[model samples]
Target: LAAGARGLLVAPSWSAPDHPARYEEWVTGLPVPTVLVERLGVPGGPLDEMDRVRSDHAHGVLLAVRHLFGLGHATPLLVARADSPTAQAVRAGYARALDVMGLRAPLPVLDSSSAERHPVLFEETARGLADAVRTGRATAALMHNDEDATWMVRRLAELDVRVPGDLALVTYDDEVAALADTPLTAVAPPKRAVGRRAAELLVERLTTPGAEAEPRVHLDLLPTLRVRASCGPPTSP
Candidate 1:
């Protein structure tokens, strides 16, 4: 309130805990225009009327997994933050994709809170994935974010596991981080466009106070899958 910010644009860090709640509270009690980028299930009280844009995690995950399955991956595990709605949606998409192909299984899930606390966990996850590949358990992995996928890929390489050759990897968010990696494959979210649209909606509400519009606005942006080199044809030759 003290700062001279005309409008507030809240883009919560996906890696942060309690980001959803923090975002919810941040938008509360503020008269200025506000925009938020959040997952599903974040409470949108009167603020629901506010202009917001969200990434369609479910669709993004499903598209990526479907592509991997089309390429011959059988069992795909979903990796995400523990107990996140985004994770749940991604998992649902994974299951739906598998079910569509009639190859769905009880896939493994790995959740590590905050990348900072799980430095070693990435390596462990890579080892576990390698074991799965060796034992013919899992053939591909779907990560919640590009960071997790990148870490898993590096770790797998350290373990002498060849990407796409032995195991396939996929992830959400094709930001710079994902593109910087070798053979990066990711589902890119329309972040800037989402922010711009959300901002425009908030500005409209601010300029037209008490307009006869609903109190909440829910916007869903489509995300696309970007295939890269980390994943490959199924190892059935």
Candidate 2:
């Protein structure tokens, strides 16, 4: 209010799993129009009525699982962290996708937390994945984000596990997945679109005289999968 801003596009921090309720309370009381970007509010919660835009991570997980199945692989094992909203979404999405596809998890979801900060955790996670592949427990896997997946690949190579040949891998967040030696297949969220839509929504609310009378909008943009060398070619069936 002091700066004379007409509207606000708020993007809450995703560094932690849970967002502070006080922040939501503050945003709720703001006089100016506000729109959230890439931040999902719990249904029926305090910020439930707020306008927001986020990626449909559940659909992204489904795409990864379905692609692996198309390549003659069983349900892909999930390797993810629980540190952020996106990570949690991917974890839940994997389980839901398995239920939808009527497939059982061959192995428990592996935790790749702190792998970037801890080389030991990274090595351990990579070993677990290699063991799953070598023992015929899993033929495919979906790792969250690009950094951890790339680290896992490097460690797996050391353990004599070959990408695609031994374990067809798909990673979330296409950011650096392409730069990996094997060029990991990844899910690409529409980040720019989310920001653009949030801004547009805020602008509409600020400009439209009767915008408060209109129902709030919640947009879930679907993410696209980028196929690469990691998952190999789809099997001819």
Candidate 3:
């Protein structure tokens, strides 16, 4: 809508590393001001003038994963799409959290992006969970998002594995699915605040032409954990 009206293009984080390069190409011919939120790296040239706000996605992941580990889940698996910055951040945080707990070296981390390429990714992931258990790789798994966690739950049931009994789960984003099924343990991001701040910054830039302000704006929002039945005492059997 903004682009059509010859207005500013204010968008959220592309999340993927390759997206920004493509986005830059798409807006190359346009004369409108473009603002990107939560970008990972610094921009170049005039595009570098675009405004940004950084959130503490890494800390958020760490907080949630640490909480689960502290609750006695020694081996927790992080489930995410392969090669995604969000996934990388979560994995890094999970590793750091485990280190702080005095745990041993890293455990298994699953990437679902590889599943997207193969026709049997879903089935493969479901089948892989059995191996995860047999190898004692992880007693709990933290998904990149709520959608993946929900899918994992269904797959576990199909495999005759009881949630929290056989495997505990956690996810980012406290979406409807998280609350729908006996309350899913999640790390809730400040989505609404992020939106509001992004809009406010863009609008401010729009109103002030050639204003001398910081080229980069970073904002880190603290994440809160929503504990539910999905995670219980590790010895609850």
Among these predictions, the greatest lDDT belongs to: 2
| 15-36 per-residue lDDT for model 1 (tens digits) | 3445555566556556666666
Higher lDDT: candidate 2 or 3?
2
Taking all chains together, the TM-score of candidate 1 against the true structure is 0.78
CA displacement after TM-score superposition, residue 154 of candidate 2 (Å): 1.0
Q: What is the C-alpha lDDT of each candidate?
A: 0.69, 0.86, 0.66
Query: Per-residue error at 189 for model 1, in Å?
Result: 0.6
Candidate 2: misplaced stretches above 4 Å? 15-23, 233-237
Candidate 2's error at 120, in angstroms?
Answer: 2.1
Backbone clash pairs for candidate 2 read none
Could you estimate the TM-score for every candidate?
Answer: 0.78, 0.92, 0.77
Query: Alpha carbon lDDT of residue 205, candidate 2?
Result: 84
Worst 10 residues of 1 by lDDT: 38-47
Summing lDDT over every window of 10 consecutive residues in candidate 2, give the lowest-scoring window.
14-23
Candidate 1 overall Cα lDDT vs. reference? Answer: 0.69
For the record, the alpha-carbon RMSD of candidate 1 to the native fold, in angstroms, is 3.6
Best by TM-score: 2
